[model samples]
Target: MRVSVVINPKAGSVNPGLIEEKIRSALFRCDLVFSKAKTLEEMDQFLCEELAHKTDFFLICGGDGTVNTCLQYLVRAEEDLTKIPPIAVVRSGTANDLAHEIGISRRIDQAVRNILEGSVRNIDIIQISSGDKKAFMLTNGGLGIPAMTADLANQVRFSLQKVANCPQTAGFFKSIAKNSYQLIKKIGPGVYSLMVAEALRTWDPNGWELEFELPGDKKFATNAPIVLVNNQPSIGNKFLPAPFTSNTDGTVNLLLAEGRRVREHLSSFLHLRNGTVSQSDRFTSYEITEFKVRSKNPSRPITFFGDGEILFKDVAELSVKCLHKGLPVVVGSPAWEK
Candidate 1:
């Protein structure tokens, strides 16, 4: 097999030396072309120039962002999907959301073994376009509270990193802290009320206007405080905002929280993990193949984030469509095989 390996040495606080050793041992009997990319630009260049053609497979050793970056560039490099190589991800980042959803192992040895022995499965990719920019999302994307929380979490992460002096360690603790806080806030006594009060006091409920077309071409409009479009089940590590979501299903799940007041917003926030928010009168959920979103006022731009990174901001309009079974990925256990 002609395999191309891309490793992000800075991912998930993994020891670069140890990962390198594992990679060497795993591919000892195969033809290997390896490169380490510490930044997105390097990964882009490598995909466009070196790994664009004639590669049988791509082994990505990093987290969601690293994997997203490689896939984005690969999709851009070859307009022909058949020319792109099947990818296997080694879960080496904080919040390996995509890896976990696809049943990829976090342990390096097991992941390597899976890469060598696994079967390929076709997976769906969310193609997003905003004005002149285009990108692809492998996990979840959202505006409103989801975007707010992401921005807040990044600030907290960077602040903690400044004190810890290690990005991986900071991220580890950040995940723990963020998850714990969310759990407590959701289940603690009076915490739900406190959250609602705080949200009412601080949050701008109708920051944007959302217009979407359902699967049957039915048009709907709403003033949503938050709109989350999911291709996977979870958001952060533990938040299963859309439990029914599947990346290979040729559809995306949209969760719209239509709560404008304290009581309505509180209900939406409280039911986020259980996905019962969809049952709420103020919430709307849909499984659709394509949709469009835009800010209410063109001058007042909004940001939508996906796969733990900001995809686009300061754009008046955006659109997302699922390219059903558009990318081939190697998995330890194929869901369809069952």
Candidate 2:
């Protein structure tokens, strides 16, 4: 098998040289022509041209952004889309949400072993569209409240010396609370209210606004405040937003936070970090193949964040859909195999 390894050197302090060594060690024992994509642009071109003409296995190593970026290229390049190579992940990123759900380890030998011993599983991909000619993977998407929080989290870090001794996510949360006063002063009370989607009204008991249309059944709108689209079952490795979802589902789970209180957000935030938010009252789940999202205004400021970074925004319309069992992924289980 010919394997292409796409790696990002900076997915939370990954040692690029060590990764190369690990993968090379594996290939030494196989009849594989090894290729590597060092940057996003190269990964994109490789997926589009190199991948389109050949049939082989490919590997991705890095954070969520790195994985999403590579998927975007493949999704765009292949029109038939059904026939493509299965990808193996190295879990070289901060969250490695995709890797965790699939049980890929970061320790080089273990991850390589998993890939070598694994079977191919078909996985789903999200297509986030804008006014431009291209679209990217929408593995996760959120706006309004948590969206603002993600942005604020980065700012808080940069403002305070742009560095930290031990900047764990918990510390980031503390910074959020400490700067909550400042955020309210600057972003206003609407900031938190946005999490509840102030404009949306949920059933007093059921929690979510349940008004969004489920694919093919536009007869009525369901109510849900925050409609989160999930590709994999977990994020940050453990949060099972939709534990039942697998790569072959041909659909992504849509989760909605149905409550109308910011105070509720406090607990939910922890759920998001700890990987259990899917069952909380502030959240609900659904499955969809395609959907559309509209902003309050056409010319307002907005940002769609995925896996802790902003991808794109500043538009009023969004066309989102799952490519439907588009890509094959590498998966292996070790501890239980014994």
Candidate 3:
């Protein structure tokens, strides 16, 4: 009983031979394998040498930055502690939202026959930082203005956010207008926080100056621009924002838009097409494990991202926590979410 599949096959409508012909017809004896990461340093050496522990399971298709690059080598080998494995997914690229919140299967032979009829679950990960150079170990990280629209939707890789369901205006305003001239030839000073969050429409955007601390000592600013630091629930599940974010919740919710509930998340676009965007106010909501992101206008630092990819800027500080280091997901028994 062995299984290993990490085929990205350049994602986006991937067809690595139709996920190797339906995981070779739903593993009649299992032991099927595939790994074609194609650089994130060869998927960090096929996820730390032969899919770490020669695959008991490791299936992933792309998007959510290749599931945060295979959870940054399985969460830094458990923060350099090691010995951890269990992950499965297939919802190929373009905002699958952790495979629709760990349910997997946008249909690759029914997510590989529910991983040849599965068993396993323990999910929750989100750790980013600026102190020791760890910026994105994600399930979607964040910073104000949807962390600069996930760094302008990772510089235009086939715009219109590869097919958006409004994922923050097609993944952050069409990745800052289809990669603003190749991100101004590579981060030439975050094009002034991408032109002050596009002429102050607000992503907590307008005119720099940042300072934040939460999880208990609550202090803040994005110069009174509404806020949003969520880890997942689809930033474009029509802005479900942090709608009770939980993968087993260690905690990192914080959705503050403040005062008049930041005018109900800046008039939350009249509840975008019915996803209900949790109708902003009471400065959103807050739950935490750790936090801090500072900016006193040190040239518009205040940058960080994961699901959208950025990572950093002139930023002086950044941190997020909650790492119950989990993986190994597949749950479908009500005759499969019928």
Question: Could you report the Cα RMSD, in angstroms, for every candidate shown?
Answer: 5.9, 8.3, 17.3
lDDT of each: 0.73, 0.60, 0.60
Residue 92 lDDT in candidate 3: 63
Compared with the true structure, model 1 gives a TM-score of 0.82
TM-score of 3: 0.32
Candidate with better lDDT, 1 vs 3: 1
Model 3 misses residue 320 by how many Å?
6.3
TM-score of 2: 0.72
Ranking by TM-score: 1, 2, 3
Give the per-residue lDDT of model 3 (tens digit) for 150-204. Answer: 5554554434334332455655665665454344424432333343344235453
All candidates: TM-score? 0.82, 0.72, 0.32
Q: How far out, in Å, is residue 300 in model 2?
A: 4.7
| Worst-scoring 10-residue span by lDDT in model 3 | 184-193
**Candidate 1, residues 1-338: lDDT per residue as tens digits?**
77788888756657767876887787787677778976677777777665545788888887787788887888888888766888988877655778877778666766766667777888999988987789898998787766665555545444544445545666777677656544432332233233334445566754456666565667777788768889988765545678888899999988887767767666677677565665667666788898887676765577887876677877777888999988989887542221
User: Count of backbone clashes for each model?
Assistant: 0, 11, 8
lDDT of 2 by residue, 1-338 (tens): 66767767645455777888888887676544434565666667666665755747777777666777777677666677676688888876544666766767667667766666877777677777767734655356565454555455445434532233336546876566546534433442233334333322321323222234457656334333345667766544434566676656777776766545555654665576567775576776667787666654444434566655656656565666777767778776656221
